[model samples]
Target: MPHKDTQGRRDSTGGVGGPRPQEGSPRGGLTLSKPSQRRTGRGRAEEELTRLVSEARLLEGLSDSLRDMVMRAQAYLAELRTAGSTLENLAGQEGVEVLVPIGAGSLVKASIKDADKVIVSLGADVAVEVDVEKAKEIIGNRLAEAQKALQDYVARLREVERALSAYRERIRSLLEERGLAGGPEERSK
Candidate 1:
């Protein structure tokens, strides 16, 4: 049983009518929760579905970003491999004509006057002159490291793809259960 106050306010906790509790009417008068505040079972399920769909979209964005990283890592690995190959081919070709890139895959004939030594960048705007063999070794090590990084990126992309796949399946199942399989896109298509 609840109590009423002078202003006719009801106390659901059976005290002097002070403030209404969040739910219930005064001792079984009616289910007096505001219609907007009242959540049906179906409404809660729909909310869950909405939340899942949003999470799937978020995961999809993450997957796209991971894919871009994988592509960049692959391109970097290819460039490192190409540089290593060029260095290996120049190992014993001092004072000979060689094709060198002017820009954008365009090569011009150039003479290797000093192929015995080369300037190797130690990164951060720092470079040191080293013999051809040492430069090649350094490039080889860099190539290996780049290859490993590429592998790591690819592995992470695969993991993201797998998670994206699972999310897609779950989203599909949820939609099908709600009779919204394929959603509006399918109908429009």
Candidate 2:
């Protein structure tokens, strides 16, 4: 005879000099181990699904930030283009009086001293005086860089969206497999 544990599972070591339980005993003792093992497997699956959903949410937030950055970059490019056009128009004018903004909706009347020279910011609070053609070139380069940055951010956002979609699909499939796909109301119970 074989020894049985408290829940009727066969002991790892049979009683000394006794016969072992048949691997497929009619008492169905082997099946008793399945419920606890299934519970463990289900718990692990739920944890993994939760983790994936959290990661997807974070990626969505990152995607939104990237989209905002792209929009800002595009707006800056438009401003640069406008500046370049204004400089071109001023290049051919002589003794042109312009209203320069001094922030806070204030403007100061100024006369162009040198129509050929324009001051271009080189970032880091640094500005340099350049001729009209050089200023236009700098603006063009800045526009190109801004466009490239916008494209890169858009691509990254698409990649994040793809990852989010994939995670959502996995979560859905796992929930359906576990018969928990009726939504949060059902899962809570």
lDDT of 2: 0.82
RMSD of each: 7.2, 7.9
Stretches off by above 4 angstroms in model 1 are: 1-27, 31-39, 183-189
Q: Tell me the tens digit of each residue's lDDT in model 2 across 1-189.
A: 557765565553465333334555886544435676688688879899889888888988998898899889889989988997897798667687989889999999998788888899998999999999999899988889988988898898889889888988898899889887876888787
- In each prediction, how many residue pairs overlap at the backbone (N, C-alpha, C within less than 3 A)? 0, 0
Provide TM-scores for the models.
0.71, 0.73
Deviation in Å, model 1, residue 55 alpha carbon: 2.1
Model 1's TM-score against the true structure: 0.71
**lDDT for model 1, on a 0 to 1 scale?**
0.77
Q: List the residue pairs that clash in candidate 2.
A: none
Candidate 2 TM-score, C-alpha based = 0.73
Q: Rate the local accuracy (lDDT) of all candidates.
A: 0.77, 0.82
Clashes of 1: 0
